[model samples]
Target: MQDRAEATRNAVLHAAAELFSERGYAATSISDISERSGRTSGAIYFHYTNKEQLALALVDAHFSAWPSVIARHDATARPALEKLVGLSFAVARTFRDDVLVRAGARLWTERKSIDIEMPLPFVDWITTVERLLAQARAAGELAAQAEPSRDAPNLVAAFFGLHTLSDVLDDRMLIEDRLANFWLLLLPGLQADPAPRALLARAGGRVTTGHPARVPDGTER
Candidate 1:
């Protein structure tokens, strides 16, 4: 009985995440989630009291999963600059592969309607970049005039804008090309040695050109 109930709960959450990602919270409905999940309304309500609570749950799930990506990069003993470049690719992969992330990102922009206490999604990302930039500065990896405080937010803003562009173009792979171009343009300003571009070339993988696949269906891929 417990196992069956857990299955039902998972179905509802995945369905809600997909709907929320494709359609903002204002437009999504319990009936919509129910239809997508092929579960009854009672099943959804059993897992969530209402749509607002469900939305918060979805965002929280995304946040919980996000840091593991960073932790993986940190585990590699890579320098802060390498980690910074790696982190951007990891995030692009996340936004491409995870429906919870896509929905959570979409929901974050609609937090005013949810009445929840969740922090803005970008805040944690910006903080993570700030810490990395500080590390880079301490190690003399950054330019002599590079300010961690300023550069961290600028990096976050730049990536955030790129993420938005991927959504508009419906081509997540565009991020890799743009990021390659972005690094080409920005790295000289940020790096003291100018040798770190090799790190991107080594790890950044093939830059594919293709039509954007629709956002993932929130199932763990």
Candidate 2:
């Protein structure tokens, strides 16, 4: 009974996520979710009191998504720099492929419409990047000139810009490609030395998902 109930909840969530991804929050209705999920309205209500609750769940999921990906790379015992490179690609894939993430991005943008307080975006990512970058610099995998404190927020901003632009310009198929290019452009400036920089030369095109497929392999945003 518990398993069945969980499955029903997931179906509703999935349905809602897909709709929210395809349509803006204002455009999507409970009836649309019902049709998409094939679950009764009562079932959805049992799990989520309303659409705002569903939106918050996806928003929370997006924020919650980073740790598992980080765990995957952390388990590999690779240099923090390599792990960071792989982590970026992993997140790109998730942003492009995961309905939950896709909806989460949309929901975040539409947060004002939802009555409940949502998690503030990007602070955790900036903090995480700062920590990893410090580790990379300490490991001598990054340049002496590199400043994690300054770079972390910039890196997060750049990544999210790529994430959002790819979605807006071409349905996100170009995300990995764009990120790879961005890495190609960034590494020469960001890495501490030639060898360390080379580690991320293929940044735009590579994926480090053995970590879990999202940081799931990065910044978690």
* Global Cα lDDT for candidate 2: 0.80
Model 2 alpha-carbon drift over 4 Å, by segment: 195-197, 201-204, 207-221
N/CA/C clash count, model 1: 0
Best by lDDT: 1
Off by over 4 Å in 1: 205-221
Candidate 1 per-residue lDDT over residues 41-112, each given as its tens digit = 988998898998898888898889877888888788788888888888888888888898888888988888
Clashes of each: 0, 11
Each candidate structure's TM-score, on Cα atoms with residue i matched to residue i, is 0.87, 0.88
